[model samples]
Target chain A: MAKQDRAIRTRRMILLAAAKVFEERGYQAATISEILAEAGVTKGALYFHFKSKDDLALGVLDEQDSHFVVPDRACKMQEIVDAVMLHAYRLQTNPMVRASVRLAMDQKAADLDRSGPFLRWSNVIQQLLEGAQARGELLSHITPARTADVFVGSFAGIQSMSQTISDYEDLMGRVSDLLRHLLPSVAQPSVIASLHMSGSRGAVVHEEVERLQEHDPSALAVG
Target chain B: MAKQDRAIRTRRMILLAAAKVFEERGYQAATISEILAEAGVTKGALYFHFKSKDDLALGVLDEQDSHFVVPDRACKMQEIVDAVMLHAYRLQTNPMVRASVRLAMDQKAADLDRSGPFLRWSNVIQQLLEGAQARGELLSHITPARTADVFVGSFAGIQSMSQTISDYEDLMGRVSDLLRHLLPSVAQPSVIASLHMSGSRGAVVHEEVERLQEHDPSALAVG
Candidate 1:
C-alpha cells in the first residue's frame, strides 16, 4: 500500500511538472528532459506513467475536468453558471487548469489532438441545458446542443482574450459579463433574475466545491 | 513603375508562402527557409521584403483585415453582421486569412503578441454597436463595448470549434447561429426582425464588397 501511494505521488508530481513545462513552452516546444528536471523524478518513472509527450499532454487535458464537480442546484441555469464560474476560478488559481487550457488552445501542437476539451465542455454544457429545458428553465427557442456549442466556444474565446489581455486577472469579470449577455438569451427572465452571475461568484463556488470534496474525499479523485 | 510592380508582386509571393507555412506548422515551428522555398523567391528578395520570420507572420496577420473591407450599411446592426459573415466567408475561402487567424490564436507563439487582432476586432464591433445604439436599434441595457467583446470572443471560439470539428466547412452556419442567439439580446426586436442573419449572408456580402473594390481598386490596398 505504501509503495502504491508513492507511485501515485510520483505520477502526480510528473503530471504537475509536465503541466508547468507545457504551459511555459507549449506542446511542440516542451521537452521531456525539462519536465523530468522539473519533477526530479527518474526518467524510468516518467516513461512508466506516460509513454510520450502526446500521452503526457493528454493526461494534462484530462486533468482539467477530472476532479472539480459542482454540486447540484435547484435551478439548472444557476447550476450551469456555477460550473462555468468554478472553471474561471480554477483557471485563475490552478496551474494545471491553465496548462490544460493552453494545450487545448494551442493551434501549434499539430501532433496533439486538442478537440477533447472543447467537445467535453460542449457536451457537459449541453446536458445541463437539456436538464434545464426539461424543467422549462430555457426559453421556447433554445436548442440545447447549439446553445451548448456557443457557450463552450464563447467561453474558450473569452478566456483566451482574458489570458492575452490580463493573464486572467480579469477572467472572472469577463466570464460574468458573458453570463450576463448569454443567459438572458437562453433562460427565462425569472430564472436569469435568480441566478448569481457576479465576477466574485467563482471564488464562492470554488469554496463550496472544496468543502463538499472535503466531506466526501472520493469526490476529489484525479482521473 | 514596372520595377515597382515586380517588387510588389515579389513581396506578395513571399507573404503568401509564409502564410502557407505558418498555417501548416504554426508560428513557432515554421521556418523562413521553408517559406522561401515555397515562394520560389531568392534569399535576397525575401530578406529585402521581411526582416525575419516574425515580420513575415505579422505581414500575414495584417492581410486578414487589409483587403476585405465590408461596405457600410444604413443599419449598423446589419453592417456588423456583414463584417462577421464576411470574415467567416474569407476564413472558408482564403488561405492567408486562415494563416493569420491561426497565428492570432496561437497561444504558443510567446514571442508574438496575439492581442492586436482581438482588440482591433472588439474596437471595430464596438463602434458599429455604438452606431446601432445611436440609431435606436439597440436594447436599452446594451453596452456597446461589453457586447462587442462578447461578439468578438464568441465568434473567435465558434470559428475555432468549427475549424477543429469540420475544418470550417460548416463555419458559416455556425456563425449564423451565433448571431441569431446574441442579436436578440442586444438589438431591438424590430431591428432583429429586419436583419438578415442567414448562413448565406457571407457570400452575398463578399460579392457586394468585391464589386465595390473592383470599382475602386484603391479600396483593396494591401495594408
Candidate 2:
C-alpha cells in the first residue's frame, strides 16, 4: 500500500510538471526532458505512466478533470448559477486554474472530444436545467441543451475577459449580473424568486454581489 | 510613382504569403525562408519589407486589420448587431477568416499592448462599445472597456465552439443563435428587434434554425 501511494504521488507530480511546461511552452514546443527535470522523476517512471508525449498530454487533461469537481448538492437553478460564478471566481484566483485555462484555450487539438472541461460543466448545468424544467422551474420553451451551451460559452467568454482586463476585479459579480438578466427570460418565476430569497446567505451569490459593489461598482447597478 | 506602387504590391504579396505560412506552421515553426519561397520573392526582397520573422508576423496582423473596416454608416442598434452577426457569418464561410480565427485564438498572447490580432480587435470593440454608450444605446452602468473584453472573448469562444461542433456550412448559424441569446441582454431593444427581423432573411440564421428543426426539434422550440 505504501509503495502504491508513492507511485500515485510520483504520477501526480509528473502530471503537474507536464501541465506547467505545456502551459508555458505550448503543446508542440514543450519537451519531456523539461517535464522530467521539473518533476524530479526518471524517464523510466515517466514512460511507465504515459506511453508518449500525446499520452502524457491526455494524462494531464485527465488530471485536470479530476480537479474540477462540481458541488454535488440539490439546489435551485440560481444556486447552481451562483456555483458556476463562484467556480469562475475561484479559477480567477487560483494559479493552477489560470494555467489550465491557458492550456485549454491553446490546446485546440486536445479538444477533439466535445466532452472537455467546458462541455462537462455544460452537461452538469444541462442536467440541472432538465430538473428545473421537469419541475416547471424553467420556461416551457427553454431548451435545456441550448441554454446549457449558451451559459457555458458565455461563462468561458467571461473568464477570458476577466483575465484580459486587469482593473475588472469583480468577475463573479459581472457573471451574476449577466445571469440575472438571462435567467428572467428562461427561468420560471418560482425559480427566480427562490434564488432571490436565498441570495442573502448563499455565499456564492451574495459574496459575488458584495465583492462587486466593493471593487467594481460600474459592473453591478442596483437599479 | 510606378516604383512606389510596385514596392507596395510586393509588400502586400509578401504579407499574404507570410500569413499563409504562419497559419500552416504556426509562429515558432514558420521561417522567413519558407515565407520567401512561398511568395516567390528573393531573400533581399523579404528583408527589405520585414526586419525579422516577428516583424513579418506583425505585418501579417496589420494587413488583416486593414480588411476589418468598421461599417461607415450608423443606423439603429439592431443594424449594428446584424452587421456584426453578418460579419461573423462571413467568417464562418471564409477560409481566410477561419485561418485568422485559429491564429488569433491559439497563437496570440492576451496582452492588449502587444501587437497581436486579439488585442487589436479588443481595442476596436472597446471604441465601438464606448460609442454605443455615448449614444445611449447601451446601459450607462456597463463599462465600455470591460464589455469590449467580454464581447471579443465571447466571440472567440463561440467561434471556437462552432468550429468544433459543426462543419463550415453550419458554423455561422450556431454562432448567430448564440449571439441572439447574448445580444438581447446587453444591446438595446431596438437592436434586438432588428436582429430578429433580419433573421427572416439571414441565410445562416434561417438555415441554422431549419437544421435544428430537422436534427433536434428542441433547439428550434427554444429559439
Candidate 3:
C-alpha cells in the first residue's frame, strides 16, 4: 500500500509538472526531461509510469479532468450564474488552473484531446438549461443546445480575452454584463429580472475579491 | 520594372505554396525548403522576398487580408444577415478559404498580427449596426459594439463547428435562424416583421444552393 501510494504521488507530480511545462513552452517545445526535472522524478520512474511523451500529455489531461469536479448545489438560475462566474474567477486566481487554461488554448496542444473539460462543462450547462426549461424559467422557443453553445462559447471568448489582458476586474465585469444582456434572449422574464437584481452584485463582489488577490497576493494572505 | 514584376509574381506564388503547405502540415511543422520547392523559387529569391518562415507566414496573412474582401453594399438588417450567410457559404465552398480559416484558428498563428482581415469584416458589421441605430431600427439600449461582438462571435462559432463537422447546410440554416431571432431583440418591430417574411426565404435559398454546390462542385464550375 505504501509503494502504491508513492507511485500515485509520483504520477501526480509528473502530471502537474508536465502541465506547467506544456503551458509555458507549448507542447511542441516542451521536453520530457524538463517535466521530469520539475517533478523531481527519476527518468526510470517517468518511463515506468508513461510509455511516451504523448502518453504523459494524455495523463496530464486525465489528471486535469479528475481535479476539476463541478459542484452539485441546488440554486436558482441567478445562483447558478454566480457559481459559474465564481468558478471562472477562481480559475483566474489559481496558478495551476491558469496554466491549465493556457495549455488548453495552446494550438500545439490541440492533439491532446483537451475537449474533455469543455464537453464536461457543456454537459453541466446543458443540465442547468434543461432544468430551467422544465421549470419554465427559459423562453419557450429557446433550444437548450443553442443556449448552451452560446453560453459556453462566450465564456471561452471572455476567458481568452481576460487571459490576454490579465485585467480581471474590468473583463469580469464585462463578462457578467454580457451574460446579463444575453440571458433575456433565452431566459424567462422573471428569471431575467431576478438575475438583474442580484446576479450583477454577486459577480461584482466575487470579481473584486479575485482582483484584490491578483493585485496583492501577500496582502490577501495577510488579510 | 521587369525585375519588380518577377519579384511580385514570385512572392504571390510563394504565398500560395506556403498556404498549401501550412494547411497540410500546420504552421510549426511546415518547412521553408518545402515551401521554396513548391513555389519553384530559389532559396535566394525566397530570402529576398521574406526574411524567414515567420515573415512568409505574415505574408500569407497579408495575402488573405487582400483576397477575401467583403462587399460594401448598403442594405437592410435582413440583407446584411443574408450577406453574412452567403459569406459563410462561400467559405464552405472554397477550399483555400477553408484552409485559411483553419490557419487562422491555429494557436501558433493566432500570435501573428493577422487582425487586418478580421478588423475589416468586423467594421462592416459595426457599420450595419450603426445604420440600424441611426434609422431608429435598433433598440435605444442596444449598442453597436455589443451587437457586433455577438454577431461576429456567433458566426465564428458556427463556422468553426461547421468546419469540424462538414455539415454546412443545417449549421448555416441554424445560424441564419438564430440571427433572424436575434435581430428582433435589437431591431424595431417593423424591421423584425420584414426580416421574418423576407429573411427566411433568402436564408433557405442561400443554404440550399450552397448545399447543392457543396455536394457537386462541378455544378458551380459548369454554371
DockQ of each: 0.64, 0.27, 0.25
List ranges where model 3 is wrong by over 4 Å.
Answer: A1-9, A28-31, A47-52, A59-75, A102-114, A161-170, A196-223, B1-9, B24-31, B63-65, B68-74, B108-111, B114-118, B161-184, B196-223
State the displacement of the C-alpha of residue A122, model 3, in Å, after optimal TM-score superposition.
1.7
Question: What are the TM-scores, per candidate, against the unseen true structure?
Answer: 0.93, 0.75, 0.74
Relative to the true structure, candidate 2 reaches a TM of 0.75
lDDT per residue (tens digit) for residues B1-223 in model 3: 6988977888888888888887776677689999988989889988988998888777765553354322232335654565566566656565555555556545444355544445555566777778767777787888787667556544554555444333355556556545644565677777776753332454464555567666754433110
The C-alpha stretches of model 2 lying farther than 4 A from their native spots are A72-75, A107-115, A164-181, A188-223, B63-65, B70-75, B107-146, B167-169, B187-191, B196-223
List residue ranges in candidate 1 displaced over 4 A. A216-223, B216-223
The alpha-carbon lDDT assigned to residue A157 of candidate 1 equals: 85
Model 1 over residues A28-74: C-alpha lDDT tens digits? 76899999999999999999999998899999998888665777778
lDDT of each: 0.85, 0.61, 0.61
For each of the candidates, give the backbone clash count: 0, 1, 0
Model 1 chain A: lowest-lDDT 10 consecutive positions: A214-223
When 1 and 3 are scored with lDDT, the better candidate is 1
What interface RMSD does every candidate have?
A: 1.5, 3.4, 4.1
Question: Whose TM-score is higher: candidate 1's or candidate 3's?
Answer: 1
Q: Candidate 1 or 3, higher DockQ?
A: 1
Q: Which is superior by lDDT, 1 or 2?
A: 1
